[model samples]
Target: MPPKAKSKKKGGNVKSSTVMDGLSTEDMSKDQLEEHIIHLREELDREQEEKSYFQLERDKIQAFWEISKRNLDKTKAELRNRSRERDEAEERHRVEIEVFWTVTGIHATLNFNEIPSTGTGPMAPQHDGTATKWYCG
Candidate 1:
């Protein structure tokens, strides 16, 4: 004859249909419950601290990016203005050279070369045609 199987029952009067189904949840100790609560609190605190630090770092990065953008914009504007001035000056210089050639009537045979005439001074002029005329200031 075979041995009898173990019974799985909830209460003394009730009958369970599955094996190892007679366990009850009224058995946790008070110390175990307190330790679980403390662990959960520590985890929450650590997460909150990390969130605060990340927020501060993000703000600092945003500020630095804004400053860099402003500086770049200012630099671009300055470069644009400087280029315009340089182009205008070059156009004026070209017109002045044409007028000088027309007025001087230095022979077409002459090999035109620039020769600075002014000896020395802050206001000294730069030359381009004959030994006497100065084309640049």
Candidate 2:
């Protein structure tokens, strides 16, 4: 029988899965492998510490964002209330002005004949048959 051909894996190129898997045990001594393992473990520890620090920073930023968003919502609500108050006050002022003008026009017309121009009051207008003159105290 012919020598069996070397079996080949039928797939895409695959690398060894572990940190030490790619290293050749035949080339490296036991002490070298142990030292490499220690270094890899230290590097993993440092990376884990850095990851934790970044996670804390992200949490802090999220808290700040929550506070800022709450404040913004509160400010928007206050602004809306203030705007409503302003609109209501302006409407009341407009109505007051209209009523005052209406009452003034009617009062002036009705009280025109009750004034004695010469000696009655300060609001009386003096007439000399041609032009009317007003005097103020």
Candidate 3:
């Protein structure tokens, strides 16, 4: 038999060159390659788990933003409704004041000879639903 082949060192470490020379791409079986792939998959799964925690917090913030937007919209709607009711009440009060002045002027014009005095108004019905009281001279 011929003499055993001598190992050649290319880099500074002779042991690393020897170990690399012993391994070949075709020497590893399919099962060993599959085991490496499974290890890589496990590493990827761990990384995703870490990222999911931050993703959950982002989702919560988004939900809060949506709730805040809805609350703002509801406040705006309520303010608009209250403003409309106030305008209507002011209009009704203006009409009642105008009518009171017109009636007092008519009474004064028709009774120029007599002294003006405060007149009594009709009695209002006493009920829980009707809160108006009768005025006396």
Candidate 4:
């Protein structure tokens, strides 16, 4: 009610007072005041509608985020389980290798070199699980 507000526009050559949305209550007719009130109410309604739309969008995004977060956690847990399984398999393999070497060492110490080589490698057993050809034993 004090006065109609104006915005100042800056330029190199010309200065001006910018017209803003305001009512000149000093000389306003009754009809004008009513129209102004109606416009303001409509603007307020539009703003409230926009706010509601954004709130709904935010809720949808939050729900998606929660689902994605849960999926990520599940994937991480699966990876951890797989890593543990791999480590346990590696440890078992290491123990098996050690046992194989220890048994071979014992055989060597006991003069158990009973099989003859074929110059290619150790002879393959036949289908009956015996050497296909006899060798020094």
Number of the top-ranking candidate, with lDDT as the measure: 2
Whichever of 2 and 3 has more lDDT, that candidate is 2
How many residue pairs in model 1 have overlapping backbones? 0
Task: Give the TM-scores of the predictions, in the order they appear.
Answer: 0.57, 0.60, 0.45, 0.56
> What is candidate 1's lDDT per residue for 1-137, written digit by digit as tens?
89999989775695333222242223435675566568769999999999999999999999999999999999999999999999898789768777877899853344334543446543244344553433333
The pairs that clash in candidate 2 are: none
Which residues of candidate 4, in runs, are more than 4 Å off? Answer: 1-22, 104-137
lDDT (Cα, tens digit) per residue for candidate 2, span 1-137: 99999979879786653436576645667798788779889999999999999999999999999999999999999999999999898778667756976887633223344454656565357665555554432
Question: What ordering of candidates by lDDT runs from best to worst?
Answer: 2, 1, 4, 3
C-alpha-based local distance difference test score of model 4: 0.66
Model 4, range 1-137, lDDT digits (tens) per residue?
79988977676576433232554554567787677778889999999999999999999999999999999999999999999999898778667756976887633122323554445432232222333442211
Clashing pairs in 1: none
* Best of the candidates, TM-score: 2
Question: What is the alpha-carbon lDDT for the whole of candidate 2?
Answer: 0.73
Q: What is the C-alpha lDDT of each candidate?
A: 0.67, 0.73, 0.63, 0.66
